[model samples]
Target: MTIYRELVIHLKEETMKDIELLVIYQNAKTLLFHDSKQTNTIEDFVTGCIHHYIDRVKHQIDLSGINDLGKPYRLQNHLKEYIDKKGISQAMLAERTGIGASNLSLIMKNKNQPSLDYFFRIWIALECPPLDKILYRVEE
Candidate 1:
């Protein structure tokens, strides 16, 4: 089935608001809408909505376990998972955030702990949820 049908099913299951659905549906439509198209069909509308919902779901799932780091080691694992999912190369992230790839690599490998500034830069580059939600302090 198309993305729109999937979104309609999800919306029906969750009973989402029409306005909310319209806003999300429009974003997808804007991306996929073509001047060659004659009219917007139900399938097209539904596809747009589904695409938007999928994007939102991906972002939300990406933030999972961000607040559950109990140890420095666990934090490193979380970072690794995030980096893998985000498809961000260490060198690219470092360049974008003005940090050294070696430092990011060390942090991901659990050999080093990043300072707040470094963490903030990484967070911004990843666009990952709130920094506090993604970070945990190790207990003594």
Candidate 2:
């Protein structure tokens, strides 16, 4: 068995649960804590729960001489979707972020991970869209 396995937990909406939550920061592979003690916004709390729902199919892989969960996690982002939906051109975004068009293209396609500086510049340029809306975790 893997260190992490599938578990479907149902919680009532009227109250909060004391569950631990981990979230991916933007397109970066780093995980951020989004538990009750740290989250300041409803969006963070809700998205933490959403990540739990999405992480429903993790399994074992042979490696590491122990419980190997494997790389079932993928960085999913909607930068291009938001840009297109908002009718924001790539050139305009580049100008707003002061990043090159090619770099922005790489970030949008999830082909490359942007620096923390570049990530926030792009996020802020987009009018501070909810972090969850722009990025999410998908387990495969």
Number of the top TM-score candidate:
2
Which digits, one per residue and each the tens of the lDDT, describe model 2 over residues 31-133? Answer: 2433334323445555666776565334222232223346565556789999999999989999999999999999888888788899899999999876656
lDDT of 1 at 97: 86
lDDT of 1 by residue, 59-83 (tens): 5543234455653333433565677
The candidate scoring highest on lDDT is 2
Stretch of 10 with least lDDT, candidate 2: 20-29
Local distance difference test, candidate 1: 0.65
**Model 1: residue 130 alpha-carbon error in angstroms:** 5.2
Alpha-carbon shift of residue 126 in model 1 (angstroms): 0.4
Off by over 4 Å in 2: 1-71
TM-score of 1: 0.44
Measured over all alpha carbons after superposition, the RMSD of each candidate to the real structure, in angstroms, is 8.0, 13.7
User: Pairs clashing in candidate 2?
Assistant: none
Q: lDDT for every model?
A: 0.65, 0.69
